[model samples]
Structure formats: C-alpha cells, structure tokens
Target: METTNEFERYQKAKKQVEDIKGFYGHLASYVLVMGLLIFINLRYTPQYLWFVWSMLGWGIGLFFHAMKVFNWFPFFNKEWEEKKIKQYMEEEKKTNKFE
Candidate 1:
C-alpha cells in the first residue's frame, strides 16, 4: 500500500512537472514564431501591421494556457473548489438539523 501511494505521488508530480514544461515550451514557440512573423510582415509590408492580429489571437490563447498551468485564478483552482465543496456540505449539514 505504501509503495502504491508513493508511486501514485511520483506519477502526479511527474505529470505536473511535464505540464509546466509543456507550457514553457509553448511560450517559447509562440515568441519565436511571432517574432519571425512580425519580421516577415514588416519586411514585406512596412505600412501594414497585420502581425498584431495573429499575435493578439494567439496571445489570448497563451494567456489562458498560462492561467491553467499556473492556476492564476484563485477562485477556480482545486483548493478553492475543495473549500467550496466543504463549505456547502457544512451548510447542508446545518440545515438538516432534524437528521
């Protein structure tokens, strides 16, 4: 049982680390690709800044990806969910005084 628990913990940690690494990899790729795209756009069309569209669109996605990986939204994270669940359960228990 102990070994199983240890193995599960190890797997969870590994998965979390991999997720963080993946997010960083995505961020690096975004920077490199967007940089190249901006360079190309400027070189070909100096007056039109169309690269901003792709950058903005992908930037929003990247922002959400970052939020998910980092758990930036406090109210929506696992801990918050657990707390809310417990709070609601306690409230329900209180309301069921007859039981």
Candidate 2:
C-alpha cells in the first residue's frame, strides 16, 4: 500500500535524522576536547582566561548539540530540511511527468 512518494519521504526523513545524529556526535567530541582543555588549564596555568574560553566554547558546542538532539536550532531545524526535500520532490515530480 505504500506509494513511491511515501517511500521517498520516509527515506528523506530517515536521512535527515541521521544527519542530525552526526551533528550531535561531532558536537559531543568537541565538548570532550574542551573538557581536556579545561583539565589542562586547571593543572597548568590556573588562569581565569582559560576558564572563560572553556565556558564560551562549551556554550557554543552545547547549543549545537541541543539543536541536533531537539531538532530545532533556529535556522537549521527540521523545517529547513523539509523545505529542501520538498523542493527536490517537486523537481522529481516534474521530471516524472515528462517521462
């Protein structure tokens, strides 16, 4: 009972989800790097500037992570992908009609 259009939509959605997951995984690794920096700063210099940099980097990385996890990050949300998919589908529809 599943039409080709339905299957395509499903695949598109699945790929989008995977892309978001990739983003989260990347951000998590970035956070880990920042954690290492924090550790080094604490043991070596104990400077407030290092702490500040850690906080800033963590904030930016966490924001992206949350966006990926929650599927809503201002300009880079599900809606944006949806729009792109829709555009592709529209073009496909036109090509299919011609065929």
Candidate 3:
C-alpha cells in the first residue's frame, strides 16, 4: 500500500513537472514566433504596426498559462479554497453549538 501510494505521488509530481516543462516550451515558441512576426511586420509594414495585435493577444494567453503553471493566484488556488471551505464549516458548527 505504501509503495503504491509513493508511486502515485511520484507520478503526480512527474506529471506536474511535465506540465511546467510544456508551459516553458510554449512560452519559448511564443517568443520565437512573435519575434519573427514583429520582424516581418517592421520590414514589410512599419507604418501599420499590426504585429502588436497578435503580440498582445498571444501575450495575454501566455500570461494566463504561466499563471496556471506557477500557481500565481493564491486566492483562487484549489488548496486555498478547500482550506477556506473547511474553516467555514468549522465556524458554522461552532455557531450552531452556541445556538
């Protein structure tokens, strides 16, 4: 049982590492592609400067991806939500006892 649990944990950790690696890979690709787009836009249509649109759009997505990979928003994280739920339930129990 312990060995199985350990293996499960190891697998979970490995998966998480893979997810982080994938996010970084995505980020690298975004940078490379956006850089190329910017170069093309500047070389071909400097007056219009339309590459900013794609840059901003894809940048927002990459920001969210990075946030998810790094667990940046603590308030919305799963463990924090679970802890808050348990605390609220305990407080409700205490209040009911007093009532």
Q: What lDDT would each prediction earn against the true structure?
A: 0.94, 0.78, 0.92
List of clashing residue pairs for candidate 2? none
For every candidate, C-alpha RMSD to the true structure in Å: 2.2, 6.6, 2.4
For lDDT, the strongest prediction is: 1
lDDT of 3 by residue, 3-87 (tens): 9999999998998899899999999999899999999999999999999999999999999988988889767777899999999
Residue 75 in model 2: lDDT: 61
The TM-score measured for candidate 2 stands at 0.55
Q: What count of clashes does model 1 give?
A: 0
Residues 13-98 of candidate 2: C-alpha lDDT, one tens digit per residue: 89878877887777778768877887888889885547666678678877867666666666666688899899999999999998
Candidate 1: segments with Cα more than 4 A from true spot: 1-5
What is the TM-score of each predicted model, taking all chains together?
A: 0.78, 0.55, 0.76
* Candidate 3, lDDT over the whole model: 0.92
Candidate 1, 13-88: lDDT as tens digits: 8988998999999999999999999999999998999999999999999999899888888688878999999999
How do these models rank on TM-score, best leading?
1, 3, 2
Tell me the spans in candidate 3 whose CA falls farther than 4 Å from its real position.
Answer: 84-99
Instruction: List runs of model 2 lying over 4 Å from the truth.
Output: 61-65, 73-99
For model 1, the local distance difference test gives 0.94
